[model samples]
Structures are given as C-alpha cells and as structure tokens.
Target: MGIIQNIKKNIIAKAMDKRKAANPFNPEYSDNFQLPPDAAEDQNNSHYFSVHDLKSRQSLYMRLALRGGSAPTEVWFVYRDGDGTVYMNERDHISKGESIPAAVECVEGGKKLRFTYTGPVKKGRLTDKGYVPDGNSGDTMVELDGNFSGLTDTFEFSRHMATEPVARALSREKFTKEFRAALSEHHQVHYEQSGTVTGSLKLGNREIVFDKLPAFRDHSYGKRDWNYFDRYVWLVGLLENGDFIHNSLIRYPAVTEIQAGFYKTGGKTLCVKNCTSMDELPVTGGVPEKFSYTVAYEDGSVRRVSCSLDFTVPFVFGGGTYFVNEGVSDFTVDGIKGRGITEFAFNADSSRWTRK
Candidate 1:
C-alpha cells in the first residue's frame, strides 16, 4: 500500500507539471497565489476607494481598513486643494451579545437609497494563513463619499438591521446566531451580505449607482503579539473611468510591509508583490504616499495612474498607526488624464471606511 501511494503521488505530480508546461499562464491554474494565510500578513486588514467629478473639478475618496481590538478603530483622509480640502473617513464597531441592525436612508443626486444589515459580525481574529476574522458588531455608522453638493456626512445606522418586522425579529438574534458567516462564499475572502445597499452618483454626463456589502477585518499584534501579517486590500466596481485600487502593508507588530496595485479599464489587474519600489509619503510618516503606478494588460494596452495628497488620513491602533494623504488622483488609462479624484471618509469611531 505504501508503494502504491507513492506511485500515485508521482503520477499526480507529473500530470501537474505537464499541464503547467502546456500553458505556463493558465488563469485556471493561476490560483491568485497569495502569501500563507497564517503568516502575519493575513491576520486583519481592508482597502476601498471611490471617484467623483463635482462641478468642474474632480473629487476622490479612499479608505484603508485595519484591524483593532481594544476599542472601535477609525481613520480619516484630507486632501488640500485650491477650494480648501476634501476628506474621507472610516470606522468599525463590534459588540458581543446582541446583533444591532438599522435602516439607512441617504440622498444622492436627488435619489434616495434604503439598505439593511442581514447578519451579525462573526469571525474576529487574525490567522497566519492570510485570512482575517471579522465580527458582526452591528453596524452603527453610515458614511458617504463622492460629490453630494455639500460637506460629507455620516449617519448613525444599525449594522445589521432588518427591512421588515419579521426580518427585524430575526436580527435581534442574528448576533448570537449567525455571527460567523463566511465573509463571502467566494474563496477570495471578500464579503457577502443578504442585506442590500442602494445609492447613486452623478459623474458629469453619467449617473452611477452603488450597492455594497461591508466586510470588516480587525486583527491586532501587540508588542509581544505574533501570528499574521498586518496588510489590507480593497476592490471596487468600475463605472466610466472607475478602477480598482489594491493597497496593503504591515502596521502594528512589525513595520515595513507594503503591497499595492491598481486594476483599470477592462482588462487584467497588476500588483506589486513587494513595496521595494513604492515611494513612501511624508504626510503619513511611513505609509506609501503619492507614487506613479502603471498597469499593463495582455492585450497590449497600458494605463498610468498617480495619487496626490491633500490630507494626512489617520488610523491609530494597539500597535502602530497609518495615515493616507487624500487629494487629486490622476489615472491615465491608455494615456488619458482626468480619471477622477479619491476621497477617504470615516465614521466617528474611525474603524472602517463606510461605503456600500
């Protein structure tokens, strides 16, 4: 039996090698290879961004979601421009016993959106395998980014509220019952909420709609703590000139960990595995500041992108802190400027970026 098992293993290995040789870059075989989940990098983190064109200029919003334990965490981004500075903020709240859900209504471009929380926070720890746990801490804040004709605003809303009374009754027990649902059914560790978010944005001649399922990951490393990496990533849906920005780095426990990338147009996304070439920003102390990034696709197309600073976005935690300079982000997809702006907004607690 031992000999037979060994022979089987050899055959499987040979088959895999043959497949790799046939197509070295098979999307099916390219498992989006990431660092080990249990490694320090995978414990707790987050990333998100949005772009808007208001009046004649452009406005942008972006947020970096990090893990926190002692209390609800938060951070904000401010961009300084001619007409003053724009801001982006984030926060996360977690409660153990009860699931708190609420109804959220916001007006964007004269349209109203109603959304509810479907479940409670479940996983809340950082592992070495790159998977960070999140909680159902009952949503308590609703923040908005982009152009709204006035200063940005945040609302006090339940994290996991029910749309109907029947749903409401279930939400009362959601925290205790379904507190550990998978962030998303997909293996990517994203998030999925049966609850819905509806919102809209008007970009010049185009009107954009938004629907989001908020996922929060808070893993902390103290002076003597060790288990995972402290890195975060954010992905957003693209409309018009919209693109996805991926940013990650080690904050608490150990410093000098950064990985960032941008996915633009309608092609493949590019990533910088190590932060060796990334130019750090002085505003955020040590965080990656304004740098030029380019994404090359398989179809012979190239896009150039850059992020400028207007403010020092702040994120204070148990181990360290992070700051993002929010301002004019010029993204040149195929060499066209005027991509849009990036704003970073947060709730009162400054735990997570409140977006759909």
Candidate 2:
C-alpha cells in the first residue's frame, strides 16, 4: 500500500509540473479574464472586496451578489477596527446603482476598479457571540470612496488545480467524492487578486484616508446556491516581505479538503500543493477567532501562517440557513507581520455543522 501510494503521488506531482506550465498564472491577470457565457444573466455572479491597513488596524469588507431577483443584488459592508465596528450596511435593501453602488466599477480593464459606496449602515458592536447591531444607533450614512489597483496578477483557482482529476484517475483507491465535488463547486471561473486601495472612507465625523493600503478581491460567477455548500475556509494576506498568500480549503459532504489559490513572492506565483492545520482552530461562540495553517507550495517551499482575529462580521442570512463567519485579522508568516481576511462559512443543513 505504501509503495502504491508513493507511485500515485509521483504521478500526480509530475502531472502538476506540466499543468503549471501549460496553464501558467497570468503576469497581470487583467483584461484577459473573461466572464462566463451567461454572465449577462447569471443568477449567482458575485464580486467581493476587502482592504486592510496594518498601521490603522482598520479594514473594509464587502460582498456584492448579482442575481437579478427581487433584490437584484445582495450587498453587505462592514468597516471596523480592534475595538469595534464604525458602521455596517443593511441586512436587506435594493441598490440604486448598476451594482451595489459600484462595488467593482472597472477603471482599467483589469488593473484597477472604482470601489465606492454611499448608503445607510448600522453601527455594530462587539459582543461575546460576535458583532451585532446596536439598534439604538439609527442608520448612519456612511461613505466609502476607494480604488483597487492590482499589485499582483489575478489568479483563477481552477486554472492551477489541473492535477486533481488526473490524480483520482491514477490512484489505487477511488475517491470519486472529492474529485467530483471540488470540480462541481468551481465549474466556473473564479479569480482572486491582491492590490492596493487608495481613497478615503467617511463614517460620520471621522474619516480614514488610505494611501495605497494593501487590498484583496475576488470575482466569481455562476450558480452560487448556499444550499449546495457544506463549509469552507479562505485566507488572503499581504506579508511585510512583500509576499502575497491567497488560498482556500473546501469541504463538501463525503468529500475531502480541496485546495486552490497561490503563494506569490518576488513577482512569481505558485499554486499551493497542500494545506494542513496542526490543531483545531480556535472558535469563539461558533466563529473561528484564530487560525493557523501550513502550506506546501508547488515550488517545493513550505510556509506557515497564523492569524489572530481582531473582529468578525457575523450575519445569518439565506433564509436562516447560512452563516458567514467573516473575520478580519492580523496575519503573521514566519514572524513577518502582516494583515488579511478570512471567511469561514457554515450551511445549516450540512451534517458537519449540525453535529457541531
């Protein structure tokens, strides 16, 4: 069995070597990214953006879902610090702009985007369970004026995972669940990029100006049905060494952990070969307050990253069947200080979440 496993591993490794070259990550990952055939009317298209400033320990996180339903879009925003949130968007509302009031307005094909929002928000307070709005504080008119300029080229997760299917075919053991589930989840183009956000965010009398604050964003489109998901963990960070790490681990029923994203440094991006955790993550009141993981890069380099979450933007939506534990945290890689964001989601119907 050991010998058989080794052979399978070797085969997958070789296939992956060829895979990277054949589907090499784009240097700029800009204008080249193409939307799906049904993007014009896709019901599950989504664009998410987050900006983190290490100096101020402040961050901006927003998600815009374009489904063209009664709501037309599902949008949410959270602005916060170590102490608590300044303001957060509505639990439900229809947008006036084309999209969440220009969540990702294209400025330069793929190099830059206009990230702005002018709307009402509730002031969320930190609590033992997580963030909850202080109802006493009425809707606060908050404005976020920002720009996202690509610092590293964009990367599509599926582009770098060409070995999964081939590995399942060659392996001695059959793991149809993993190979099939992971592929089904990412059947569409979903790309992630790290950039610099420049602009100012105004909430009430206070204002925070960002001068090229490192930011992270991802563009995903397709059928985004929360009912189909089990649970997943995602991490995106900018290290002081000028390296960028954006990776994800997904778990579906009867499936294993499927990996995606890359480790970028010195202008090169390498797909993650494997991701593992040494111990159980710290979950405070059902939210992962901290996470530590080790990743082996395709280039044969391994690195470990740990994050201490400052706050979590908690929300129970999707007909009360989904919970997104979106956490903005301070990340550290090998003692190099940095910051990033993490989103751990749970689907209520999944046995995993129910058992917990």
Candidate 3:
C-alpha cells in the first residue's frame, strides 16, 4: 500500500510540474491581463475582504459571492484581547445570484462574535478606466453586533492595469482568453486596503469603547480555488505612526517558483508595490515564530520590517490548516521607527508531495 501511494504521489507531482511549466509566473501578467466585458460578468468571479484591528485586538473577515449561486458567502469574526482569551465564529448563506442584495441581509452570530451587512453596497461608478468603489460612503456598510460595535472606515487601493503591449495582445489570444476563463472558474482578481475601526468590544460582560483602532481590509473577485498554492504566507502590519504594510509569498508547485505579493505601505492607508524578499523563522506546528522582509517601489526605494509572534488561532477549511498569528512588529522606512500588529498565515499539507 505504501509503495502504491508513493507511486501515485510521484505521478501527481510530475503532472503538477508540467502544468506549472506551462503557466510560468510572469511578473507582468497581471499588469497586462485585461478583463473583457463578458469575463467581467462571470458569475463565478467573487470578492473577499478582511479587517484586523490591533487597538481593539479583534478582526472581522468577510467574502462575497458576486455572481455565483452554487455556494454560500462566508464571514469570520474573531476577537483576542490582552487577557489571552480568544473568540471566533463563522457564518455562511446561499445568496442564489443575489449577492448584492443578500449582503444587506447576511448575518452570522455566536456567543462571542456576530456580524451583519447593515446597508446597501454603494455601487462604484464603472468607467472605461476601471471600477472605483465609491468612497466610504459608497462602499458596503457592515454592522458588527456581538463582541464589537461600529462601522468600518474602509478604503480602496488603486488598481494596477496591464500595460505591456505584448501582454495586452496576448490577453486577447484564444489560448490566453481560454486559460484565464478557466482559471476564473477557480480564481479571481484580488484587491486590498487598510483602515481604522471605531466602536467598542465586550470583555467578559464589560464594554470597552475605542475611538479609533487600526484596521486592514482586502477584496478579491472571481472564482477562487484555495488549493491552487501548495503553501503561502501573508503578513499585515499597522504601525503606531499611522503606517501600514502587507506582504504575501505564494509557492506554486507547478513552476517551482515563488510569486511574491505586492508589498504595500503608507499612512493609515497604503498603496501596493513590488516585493523583493521574505524571510521567516522555521515553522513548527504550522506557525512561524518570527519574520522579516523588504519591499521596493518602482523608483528603486525600499523599506524593511520585522515581527515576532504574540498569539495565534488555527482555522481549518477544505482539509487545510491556516494559522492566523497576531504579533508585534517594528517598521523602518527612511530612518523612521513605528510599531504595530503583525499577522501571518501558513498553509500546510504533509502528504501533498513526496520527497525522493
């Protein structure tokens, strides 16, 4: 049985390698890929965003099914105060192609956490330039009812369009179109931003109010396949000096190459830039004790940051483990010092691949 299982694993790995070779990571791909009207209308395409508040020591995660009716939308609410106690809850509902409307009525509740979309999704103006989410007034309004109460002061990042002539031309090719369409059946375009959370949270029946808490939110739209990457690391930080940073590193087994996430930084709200490197301590039991990395913009400027774990909670889905860690970190940008919350996620699967 062991020999047979090993053979099966070897075959799967070889097939994955071939696929990765065919879909090599092109740094400029996203910069060049164009979404056709039909592609943009794909019901399978979806959007997801999450917010983490360090001051309040809580986080709210949400995902919307933009067009698809096959599955339900999900929300995850988490809270971790200084007392070492943690609270979390997950909720899901079938929208049946009424995502925009359903969002206004969606609700998830538990003893420690509860959330609801209290209002309509202020639709952003669609332009030939691209979709611009209406400011906080135009964005979706969500009411967190359980551990925390208050509205999220969310912000949207600038969109990066495909500019290379070659990429643009290839994007219109039959193969490219078909490939993207197929991938969309499982993936979507991802966008994110940072924000401030205002409201109060309950600590063992005691109500604590926060005037302003540092927060971060992200949104992705399209078909999403969580298993696309063998593993990945996502770290987000919001500093005391009103700065925010996000770093992600994804490993695709097919290409044996690592696709780094766009490193972003700025005051309260940050913009996305290219990342150079990500270094971290060895992971044990699916958690990394510490991490450090650097990000560079198009102008050749760079920034460095480091973080150490404070606590972590494990979330499992689709037979995979995601360890979300909250940590303390220091950011040095242009000789300035700032501190904030740093979080990391690691996806682990011991049997996915076999070593020779």
Tens-place lDDT per residue, model 3, 1-356, is 25554454455445445654575443233222333445432333333334455444444444444333344444344444444344443233334444432232212210012223433223233233322334544233334432222222223211232112112222232334555554335544554444444555443435645454555545444544445544556666655565655565544333222323333444222323445432343444444545556665444567776554544444443344433333433445445544444444444664432211
- Model 2 accuracy (lDDT, Cα): 0.69
Runs in model 1 lying further than 4 Å from the true structure: 1-51, 54-262, 267-276, 279-290, 294-302, 319-328, 338-356
Across 40-142, the per-residue lDDT of candidate 2 in tens digits comes to 3334666788887777777787776666444356777888864666578765445435445535576775578776788878887777666667878887777
* Steric clash pairs (candidate 2): none
Candidate 1 lDDT, 205-265, residue by residue in tens: 3344543321111111221122222323221222233333333322221222223333433
The better-scoring model by TM-score among 1 and 2 is 2
Write the number of the candidate with greater lDDT, choosing between 1 and 2.
Answer: 2
TM per prediction: 0.37, 0.80, 0.54
**Sort by TM-score, top down from the best:** 2, 3, 1
The prediction achieving the highest TM-score against the true structure is 2
Q: Which stretches of candidate 3 lie over 4 Å from their true place?
A: 1-73, 90-158, 161-187, 202-204, 253-285, 320-348, 351-356
**Candidate 3 clash pair list:** 31-162, 32-162, 45-222, 46-221, 46-222, 47-220, 48-220, 49-218, 186-223, 187-223
